[model samples]
Target: MKKSVALMVGLRYTGAKKSNHFISFIALVSMIGIALGTIVLITVMSVMNGFQSELQERILGMVPHVVVGERGEGVHDWPEVEKQIVQHKDVIAAAPFIDTQAMFKARGNTRYGLVQGVLPEKEKKVSIISDYFIAGSLDNLKPKEFGIILGIGVARSLGVSMGDKVTLLIADGGTVSPAGFAPRQKRFTVVGIFEVRSEADSMITMIHMQDAAAFTRKGQLVSALRVTTNNVLDAQWTAYELRNQLDDKFYVSDWNYTHGTLFKAIKMEKTMMGVLLTLIVAVAAFNIITTLVMVVNDKQSDIAILRTLGASPATIMKIFIVQGSLNGFIGTILGVIGGVALAINLPQVVAFVEQLFGVNVIPGDVYFIGFLPSELHWDDVILITSVALSLTVLATLYPAWKASRTNPAEALRYE
Candidate 1:
């Protein structure tokens, strides 16, 4: 028999329903193992991709695309820096800002917070802070006027709302008095409340640019120039460009530069997890080797007859290799289909599981995102499939070699 003919016969022999029950059972297990491993690996990769996507959108949306400040102390001319940064191609908007850690008070209540001083009109161009206006407008941020915007959480904590008065206690750099360090306390009417669903809701407060300047002791100069970009990924290069265009005292930082270390760690973790799971599929493939070798052993007499009829060693080898490989190929195809289906419906699947189990699988406080996320990337599936197919092919080598080396005379003599 030619090698092609032998391979077809071998495949038929292995898959024959009336074949030995033991061989069939082992084949079943091998298929199941491959299917399960592929499903798990694909599902995990999808979830990781989903998480990375969500985190990037939210982080970039809420945070500044780039921040330009003084490298040593503070920038004396924030307006000049802002002007230069806006010249970058991706930069959509730039605004002068001063951030201060301070205490807020209303109705004898107190809470620690980050107070942001922003240019009412310009800040809107860069950040969505204006879009979140559940209350008054930024135009109400009149210079030297006592007005403030609070996050919804901060407003609720301080027991105040729009049109209500609150006191901002500048923690430092206020005019000193006989009593103590005189607080630059201003009883400002709450004009707006915004909700970002992040720590920002509790930590962020907004005030007029002039008021923020006086409190921070940065007269006529803002602490940082907040920038928004057309493409968030271009932030780093934009920062670099801003620095290059400006003087030595100025420093620019992009979103990646600020959060690079944390992202690097996540990348490491994802790689390790994929490697650990791939071993499961590899171990499963090895079982195919055992199954093929056993099949070769049980059919020794049949092989001898085939050899007498002019079957070549290569033909015998091709037969067993095809049979073992079919087990891998079938499982892999099924796994890919099932894995992709699960990834596509993961959100609803998670919701169903939660309801069925009557449990909270993902607690909102623990995870930055509330829902189970999934993003199917075809590239990842292709890569995983290639690795699996390679491993499956490798499992056939030893068994195929053994079958090819079978001695026709020795086997037929015993029969």
Candidate 2:
């Protein structure tokens, strides 16, 4: 009976007529504040999640998940080693590759990049590089043809195109002539151009393995064995396992060893962004406190009347708690609905915004990804809603307590 009465009176106070327009406006502001804060927090966090995920796909997709190589003489028996590595269920595919750092000059422009010698058919098993081909076929890199595939950015920088000859000069390459031992140089026909929309696109070029072996003077010996696994997230552990399976003469490397720092930095930035944006919700929660305080002041007479009519202080407190909590609850529901709807379609929203503003939000050359991404995680939604609701409930306590302490005689005297 008491609970029902408290609820009835509390709701009546919340829905007070337009005569108390100031109180109504304040309540409306509090709700709007909470709603807006939740929406922004959810939307921003989703975008950050999207960035981290997309970076993983773009960066990791082109790089080896794990590499196996001989510590001393390189992987001379890479074919046998690849067979042994694949016996482990975690490894899905393995490919032989030779990697070297070199400078390429073509059409009067020069660029320094990594030159990788790969078998076209086997390379497809371990990498998604083939999927990114803009021109020419991987099969065109026939053995002894000395044909090369260049990144789009690298080709553009060097002003070269399909069928154009590029000169590759390596640090270790050169025929020793008595007076001048010059850099070993080889001419390669540009057979393909690939674009991954990343830094890799500017600094990676590929050629046939036999051509690389001849250029490096390591015939039949590959620099490394690249392997892809069933689970990329578990690549480091799988690499360690592969190392254990191999003799001490061989060493194992993974993508984490190569690009872990970059991914870690991205994750740290996302966390920091989440913490900073959460403060917006905190500020909105403060407005809830203000709203409840004003409501307490306006309802003092009502509260006193209820107290005189046999209502306990606890009931008064519960009344105001329910009232304030309801406001927050309503805002939270609306915010979640709005936030989820917006986050799921964030890419389209970004596109629309870019069009409206006449700007390119994510240019392919400037950013690793050419589109804005949003990945709404259920965990983030739950956490944000919980925090918002908790803040709103906590904000009500002090004002509710003050309302509960109203002296009926003094309140009635003023009335």
Question: Which candidate has the top score in TM-score?
Answer: 2
Candidate 2 accuracy as TM-score:
0.91
Q: Estimate each model's TM-score.
A: 0.84, 0.91
| Candidate 1 segments exceeding 4 Å error | 1-4, 71-76, 104-112, 128-170, 174-202, 205-211, 214-219, 354-364
**Which sections of candidate 2 miss by over 4 Å?**
18-22, 175-181, 353-360, 363-370
lDDT of 2 by residue, 174-254 (tens): 767788778889999999999877767888999999999999998788998999999998999999999899999999989
User: Backbone clashes in each candidate structure, one number apiece?
Assistant: 0, 2
Steric clash pairs (candidate 2): 173-184, 174-184
Expressed as tens digits, the lDDT of each residue in 1-415 for candidate 1 is 3766977797788668746788788888988899889999999989888877766765566678888888755667777776777777878998888888888889888988888898888888877767667788788887777689998778988999889998888755677778867766767889888865445667788889897777577788777888898888777887778878877877778888666665566678778878988998998888898888888898888888888888888888888888888899998988899999999999899999999999867654356555678999999999989888888889998998898888989998866
